[model samples]
Target: MPGYLEVLIILFVALLLFGNRLPNVARSLAQGIVEFRKGLKGEPENQEEKKALPPAGGQQAHGIPQGTQGGANAQGSQPPPPAQQQDPS
Candidate 1:
């Protein structure tokens, strides 16, 4: 972590460089980082992970494989449709 003095110096440089848009710039950078992390996890950018390990209602959610756990849509908020078999012809 950057120390207080280092942080203050960085802030001073930012104030000199960005004048007034520094906060907004920082906010956008943080949001971008969060989105990137979610992408890396194959998760939706802003959705919360379900507590599937606990099985919220003791029954499986619709469209999800029985006894399946982890990943999003675990709570059935946006369960994927059933898979269709492909033709071999």
Candidate 2:
């Protein structure tokens, strides 16, 4: 880890290179950290990017075509045949 003097020297060099833009750079860095934390928590910071991603499942984001079901349970299964009924006296 760097000592206080090394930290000051690095800050001074950054000030020399970034001058008035230092605040903006710091703000950008803080925003990046916040966004990173949100991502780590399984949340997206950018709604536009979220909106642009494909929807869940195999269906397209646009719309499902005419008569096709778009999920796992809809794939391949048949109902059991009905049981025979007995007449009551």
Candidate 3:
């Protein structure tokens, strides 16, 4: 266990290292904790409007088409082979 003096020294070092950004770091940490707690409790993250909206036509929830992969050649078709160039003698 650290003594009071040792704790104070550690805190002082932390303050020096984090100087102006400490408050922002603390705020971000708090927000992360709140989000984690909400996840544990199964609470929605303010996405009611998004949940109510319908998915676009022919698209899944992730916006990708239902029957196709996210590629131009999603229909299992292969590209045409390139033509060979003739060498000049």
Q: lDDT per residue, candidate 1, 1-89, as tens digits?
A: 88999999998998898988878989999999988888898975433435334456677667878657666755765869989999999
Write candidate 2's Cα lDDT for 1-88 as tens digits.
Answer: 9999999999999889889997898999999999889989998777899988888775544566645654556655556788999999
Clashing pairs in 3: none
Q: Which 10-residue span in candidate 1 carries the lowest summed lDDT?
A: 45-54
Question: How would the candidate models be sorted by TM-score, starting from the highest?
Answer: 3, 1, 2
Q: Backbone clashes per model, in order? A: 0, 0, 0
Error of 1 at 38 (Å): 0.1
- The candidate 2 region of ten consecutive residues with least summed lDDT is 60-69
Arranged by lDDT with the best first, the candidates are 3, 2, 1
lDDT of 3 by residue, 1-89 (tens): 88999999999999898899988989999999999999999878888976887787754656666666656766547677899999998
Q: Which stretches of candidate 2 lie above 4 Å from their native place?
A: 1-17, 48-89
Candidate whose lDDT is highest: 3
RMSD of each: 13.8, 13.4, 6.9
TM-score of each predicted structure versus truth: 0.36, 0.35, 0.45
lDDT (0-100) at residue 43 of candidate 1? 75
